[model samples]
Target: MTLYPATLLLHLVGVIGLFIALSLEVAVVSRLRVAKTTTQVHEWLTLSRVIDVLLPVSAVVILISGLVLTFSAWGWGHAWIELSLGLLVLLGLLGPVINGPRMKAIRVAAQAAPEGSISPALRQAIFHPVLRVYVPIPGLVALGAVIMMVLKLDWL
Candidate 1:
């Protein structure tokens, strides 16, 4: 019933949720790639609803629980904890405010268009920029967060 145990449980559950969401994305993207018609792609688009909901919720839980753990362990002044907490905040905000809406647009477009009507040029135009940037930012932030948590250094 302690804060530590509760936070740990929430963090673990958040990670599990994130893992499931990521797996769903991979499966859905693969299905989208192989889809020959709009109906097939639209069918796959339904998965986006799950991702759109779960991803941010899991991220928020992970971040809030992580911040609870950090604050409990290392007061607010601790550089590593602060850095990890900051990255978590960034992920939560950016995922929802920026990427989430863009993804929703893409999904809506996919669902609304007729089979084979989504032009290759339009597809690339719609997705390439987001695909290029959104994925890499998370990896870098995750790496920074892990290093901050593990090292617990005074890099401030």
Candidate 2:
């Protein structure tokens, strides 16, 4: 049950897309803290929109294609593969269900807050307490995915 090279290539593309999206999210947030101008704020908002829409889609494609490759390459019931895919799904779901609404609230607040008085309240909401937990989740999951893929732990 070998995978064709083309399918593997597509899966890799999805993975890379997801990675890029996450990187952009980090960059956008970094700029957000010092976003002095309205235009800068708008740019960050637009980036957030792109991330909100595209990141999940790319993640879905990555997970589905990874599953296809896993089944085709190693068959179902492989322990580490199942665990890895489940974790991927969890990571994907967390973005929309937990992070999306929070980010939207932050964005709306940012837009409403007048220039030069982007208050601490607005910044606090945008970089909420939950972010202390949420921001690191993807990185850890991605790291685990890499490790599991490389090790192929078969603990059943």
Choose the strongest candidate by TM-score. 2
Model 1 pairs in collision? 38-115
TM-score (C-alpha) between model 1 and the true structure: 0.74
In candidate 1, position 137 carries an lDDT of: 63
Alpha-carbon lDDT, every model: 0.69, 0.75
lDDT by residue (30-110, candidate 1, tens digit) is: 566566666776777787779878877888898788878876865677777777777777777776666666556667676
Q: Which candidate tops lDDT?
A: 2
